[model samples]
Target: MSQELGITVKKDQNPSEWYTQVVQKAEMADYAPVKGCMIIKPYGMKIWESIKEDFNTKIENTGAENAYFPLFIPESYLEKEEDIVEGFDPEVAWVTHGGDKELEERLAVRPTSESIIAPYMADEVRSHRDLPLRLNQWANVVRWEATDTRPFLRTREFLWQEGHTAHATEEGADEETMLRLEQYQEVIEDHLAIPSILGYKPEHDKFPGAKYTTTIETLMPDGKSIQSGTSHQLGQHFAEAFEIEFEDEDSETQTAWTTSWGLSTRTIGALIMAHGDDDGLRLPPRVAPTQVVVVPIYQEDNRDEVVEYAEEVTEELEEKGLRVDLDDRDHRTPGYKFNEWELKGVPLRVEIGPNEVEDNAVTPVRRDNGEKKMGQDREEFVEEAEEVLENIQESLYNELEEYLQENIREAESKNEILATIGKNRGYVKTRWCGKESCEEEIKDEVSAEIVVLPFEEDSKPATIQEKEDHIDGECAVCGEKAERWAYFAKNY
Candidate 1:
């Protein structure tokens, strides 16, 4: 493909520019007139819907019910949770008037629905029976950011699902938090085909008003980490602020313990950065909008036969439950069609020609690593396509796994940590004292922060105490006894 028609920058040389060109060239999104927002095109929206559908099923199965909250939150409501208000003050977009008239109480466009949803949950939950009340909303939130704009990565308004739940005990809330985090891990690994590190966010970086935050972080090709998803243990903080109390079994009034978690459109950004290349996006089979495209190669003399056979093959693949597209536009050359599908990052492509029609076979090409296979008979081709799609999914994930394994290195001291990060863009594993001061010191050196305190393998159920346990060695920066071995990376 030529520079004018396809992405001109290499993925490694200039990921930022390459990403912008790929997203636009592939028709996933377009820049909006608004400075910090983007318009999600049909292809991008399809991928997002696929993500939503998979995650919604997981959330519902966990006993959470979907609900909606108002987009505009009253100013006073934010004050109820002082930390939340302070944390979002800069990004909170205010709606000051109705048409031309000044409003009595200025409203803040929802940066997040916590303040609004917490009070509603307080009103609905009354007794122990309502103690574990769980509610979630699939909606858009506006956070007026002042950073450099990227399409799905960071925007003024983005789509996401915010889940809020109230429980009778800290144990219940803790369970709720980890459960959601695990579900996010499953989605990222199983569906999106991206490997991630799951653990706790350091104290200074925990979500505002949260007792602690748990996160699923994935490393992008740029040597930066993107927090793919996060689950927070609010621990009665919001419940106390909003008075979300319930009567216990003994009939005594008590405040509820609460937790909130979210997976956003940012995950789409992670997918693109993790697997996209100089050609364009390399979508996983599960989330790819058009997983397979059938292109027919024909001339006027054999166009009828070639086109007819291609349609038949398309029907056969469709019946097998694949997202198949038949690219039979009469004017486009086979080479052009191939480039278009590749640029769009379809996982598999099938080529049908007059020769293949006479031979009752079809050839398939894999996108993850351009490995083409010889033609197979029509009935056998269906099974081969299924296997190739599965292999592509596995291959993509394995490639990421290998990249992570090769990139994550142990650093013995603070200087080592700084040197390693400066030299390579990946995770640097090192011991830390678990102090915010020490973390800041390291950040000053390499601009990398503690991304996660990785979960340990043990027979006991994963808990905060276990996640916080120190792994080995002295603090990399402080020279004090280490609290834990943390994964540190410069984040996106």
Candidate 2:
């Protein structure tokens, strides 16, 4: 491949340019005519489909049913929840005129479906038996973002699954919230091969009408924190706003506690940035569209023989329950096919050439570490290839785990925290006095906000009591007895 055709810029030297080239050259996605919209090509869409299938099965097993809601929300309905309305107003895209005529009331394209779904949920649910309504939808949402329009990351239009649930009690709602977050962790770690830190969002950073928000955060290759997923406890806030109540066992009307959680295309962006290398995208095996690509290597004389061997290998692998593909395109050279599949991030590649056919073996190449080895026999090759893919998945997770640990630093003083933020691009773990003023002061100074408080409450040191920390002798910013340690970072 020519330099212009493949990635011209090195990831370490110019990551932004390198990323743009990979996305385009690999046939993953392209910028649309609109400013902040992207067209996900077949290759990218296939990868997304794989991810969706994995999560869909897991979600269905958890007793959640798929459902769809209207795309438009009337202004009056949106205004039901004060916090949600205020939080989303700036980003909501309004549909005012209907063709040449002005509508009686303007409608808003949903930035989220909370307001639109709550009313219908209230209407559909009438009794205590219908208390825990767990429904999810995979759809597109529009938000008029003012800046940052990277494809799959900060686009104005993005695809995602928004899950809305109503519970009988506050404790039930809270449990559901954490359960969803745990599911997110499983998907991220097992399928995406990305490690994440589970924690609670700071009050100032919690999701808009949620009583509290729990999140799973992952560190990208650039040391920036990406919120992989979030689950919110809506606490009767929207229940009262929308008056979603059910007749209880006692025959008394009681408000339902609600929760909403989502994972978006942004996770795709994170997967690219986290595992992708200077060569190209490195997708985990569980979610790779073509887990193993078979490349046939042949010269003019042995072309048919080599191609036949490649087909046999593909069939064998497929029978073993692997997603296998045979690259039998005659026009392209075997070297060219290898480069293409590498750029597309196939987990493993099987090369069957004339020499390999004579030896009754195949050469296997691993994308993760670029390791090449000879397979003893057809069965051995298939088993080894499967093992290599599993290893790559675990290797990617281990690499990211180390990166996350290195990016987080413990800061004991205000100046130290500021200095750490300036030098490193990730979270700075420091003690806070539980004061808004102190949080705001740090934010103003370093442009960093508190992102999460880890879920392990007892894991906190003895020096910290009821959010009070005696270690630093004072809050990082306020000079008061520090209450608790929290992770602060500049977020996406």
In order, the Cα lDDT scores of the candidates are: 0.90, 0.85
lDDT of 1 by residue, 47-119 (tens): 9999999999999998999999999999999999999988999999999999999999989999988899999
- What local lDDT score does residue 76 receive in model 2, on the 0 to 100 scale? 93
Candidate 2 lDDT by residue in tens digits, 1-492: 867556777787787787778888888889999998999999889878877888888889987999998888999999988898889889999999999999899999999999988998899789989979999999999999988788887899999999999999987887788888888999899999998988877777788988888899988777677888899988899989988999999999999999999998888888888888888888789889999999988888999999998898899899889999999999988778888888888998888888889988998888998888875576788776677788989998998888888898988888888899888868898877777777787789877888777655455211112333424556777777765678888777
The number of clashing residue pairs in model 1 is: 1
Candidate 2 residue spans exceeding 4 A from truth: 457-473
In model 1, which range of ten residues has the least summed lDDT? 457-466
Worst 10-residue lDDT window for candidate 2 reads 460-469
RMSD (Å) per prediction: 1.3, 2.6
Residue 189 lDDT, candidate 1, scale 0-100: 95
